[model samples]
Target: MHAIVIDDSSAMRMILKRIVTSLGFEATLAEHGRDALDKMDAADHRFDVALIDWIMPEMDGLEFIQAVRSDPRYDDVTLMMVSTESDQSKVVRALAAGAHEYLIKPFTPDAVAEKLELLGLLDPERVTAGV
Candidate 1:
C-alpha cells in the first residue's frame, strides 16, 4: 500500500515513514496540507492511505481531510488522523469530518500495525490487534 504522511515536523514524518515501511508500505511526505494537495495533483499515483497531523501551519488536518474527501480524485483513499488530540469531542469531530481512523501521538510501531491490521491493510493473522 502507498501512504501520504502529512506533518510539519520532519522528525515526525521520518518516524512515520519508518513505521509505515515496517508494514511494507511506501510513504510519501507532505509538509502541510497544501504540499499534500500539490503532490496528489501532480502525481499519477493515488494514495491508498493518508496519515494526517491534526495541527499544521497553513491548513489543519480537519480542513485537509475535508478538502481531500470532498475531491473526487481522493474519494477512494482512507483518511486517518494521526494526531495528539484525544478529547472525545475532537475525536468525534475528526470522524465526522471523514477520518477513517485516529492515532494519538506517542504511538508505537505495534499500535500502527494493529490499526492497519484491523482495517485489513495488514494481515490480521500475522499481528496482534489492539486499540
Candidate 2:
C-alpha cells in the first residue's frame, strides 16, 4: 500500500516515513498540507493513507482532511491525524472532519501499526508474521 507523511518537522517526517515503510507502505513526504496536496496530485498512484500533523504553515491537518474529504478523487484515502493535539474537543473535531483515526504525538510504532491495522491498511498476515 501507499502512504503520505505530512509534517513540517523533517525529523517527524523521516520517523513517520520509517514507520510506514516498515509497515510495507511506499510513502510520499510533504512538509505541509499544501505540499501534501500537490504531491498527491503529482503522484502516479493513489495513497492508501495519510499521516498528518495539526500545526503546519501553509495548511494544517484539519484543512488537508477537509480538502481531501470534499474531493471525490481522494475518497479512498484514509485520513489519520498524528499530532500533538490531544484535546478531547480537537479529537472530536478531527473525527467530524473525516479523520478515520487520531494518533497523538509521542506514540510508538506499535501504536501506529495498531491504528493502521484498524484502518485495514495493514495486512493481518503481515502483522502475524511480524513484518
Candidate 3:
C-alpha cells in the first residue's frame, strides 16, 4: 500500500517511513499539510493511507484530515493520526473528524503494526513489532 507521512519533523518522517517500509508499504514524505496536499494534487497516485502529525507550522493534521475527507478524490484514503496528542478528547475528536486510527507519539514499531492489523492493512499474526 502507498502511504503518506505528513510531519514537520524530518526525524519523525524518517522513523515513520522506515516503519511503513518495514511493513511492506511505500511511503512518501511531506513536511507539512499544505505540502502534502500539493504533492497529492500534482501526483497521479492516490495514497492508501495518510499518517499525519497533529501539530505543524502551516497546517495541522486535523486540518489535513478534514481537507482530505472533504474532497471526493481522497474519500477512499485511510487517514490516521500519529502524534503526541494522546488526550482522550483529541483522539475522539480526530476519530469524529474522519481519522481511521490514532497512534500516540514514541510508539514502538509493533504498535504501528498493531494499528495496521486492526485496520486490516496487515496480518496480525505475521507482524513482528519490536523492530
* Clash count, one per candidate: 0, 0, 1
Candidate number of the best lDDT: 2
Q: After superposing candidate 2, which stretches have Cα over 4 Å from the reference?
A: 128-131
In TM-score terms, which candidate is top? 2
Model 3 error, position 22 (Å): 0.8
- Quick one: ranking by TM-score, best first? 2, 3, 1
Tens-place lDDT per residue, model 1, 31-70, is 9998899988887888888899999989989999999989
lDDT of 2 by residue, 71-104 (tens): 9999999999999999999999999999999999
After the best TM-score superposition of candidate 1, give how far the Cα of residue 59 lies from its true spot, in angstroms. 0.9
- The lDDT of model 2 is 0.93
* TM-score per candidate, chains pooled: 0.93, 0.96, 0.94
Candidate 3, residue 22: the lDDT equals 85
How does residue 27 of candidate 2 score in lDDT?
Answer: 89
Rank by lDDT, descending?
2, 3, 1
